[model samples]
Target: MTSMMAPNAAGLSDADIANLAAHIASFGGAAAAPAAEAPAAEAAAAPAAAAGDVAAGKAKFAACAACHGMNGEGQGMFPKVAGQSADVLADKLKKYRAGETVGPMSAMMAPNASGLSDADIADLSAYMASL
Candidate 1:
């Protein structure tokens, strides 16, 4: 953090005060892009998940192994999904698939959920829940 002269402090030159003020102004103002663009970018990058089947979910989960771990233990920023409730998991996936939740990873999972039927969602939910 850069400090400026306290209202009445020392011998600062005019340029020094101007530079500091500029720096301070720069800190709060938007650089170029509007803040609204960020959410749009995230939405575009992420995929939306949706309802799926439990039995079919197992097969679907197979494709998720690379990042979620073989047993859904998860790694790094990836969350552990093995013991998650089916209802919750299904809901989250549905959000991702619908683009309601945007993120690069969510976007990736969205397409995977595209063709899933209701039974597939239930099965996957049950399988993941049981795990």
Candidate 2:
């Protein structure tokens, strides 16, 4: 597992982490954590929310393709978003919007998030999760 506390260069957050844990759980595995802390466990056990529009998400994802790649496989410094949960992706974006995360890598993503509406975020999240 990658560092979850590295200033979230990808702008991930507690909710995002939880969503990721839930996403992975759907496949019968859990996201790794340093310890089975309450927050981490709770995140891992949380149910996924029904949000995002796959079609709209596909459109929004076009903007992310540059970094996340066409198939969400990622390239260069970018990480994989394919198969990641929409909740996770949304939460990460929320962190970026909230200024809870940042870095040179994240800086690039920061501006991309601009002009995104909540529905856009949900759709993009759904699309990424579908990938």
Write down the TM-score of every candidate.
Answer: 0.51, 0.59
lDDT of 2 by residue, 47-130 (tens): 322557788778656557645777889876788988887777876765554445555556656545644555667787788888
Per-residue alpha-carbon lDDT of model 1 for 67-125, expressed as tens digits?
Answer: 46668888655668898877676656655545555555675566555544445556666
- The model with the greatest lDDT is 2
Q: What TM value does model 2 have?
A: 0.59
Per-residue lDDT value at 47 in model 1 = 26
Worst 10 residues of 2 by lDDT: 28-37
| Local distance difference test, each candidate | 0.56, 0.62
How much lDDT does candidate 1 score?
A: 0.56
Judge candidate 1 at residue 105 and give its lDDT.
Answer: 66
Q: RMSD of each candidate?
A: 19.1, 14.6
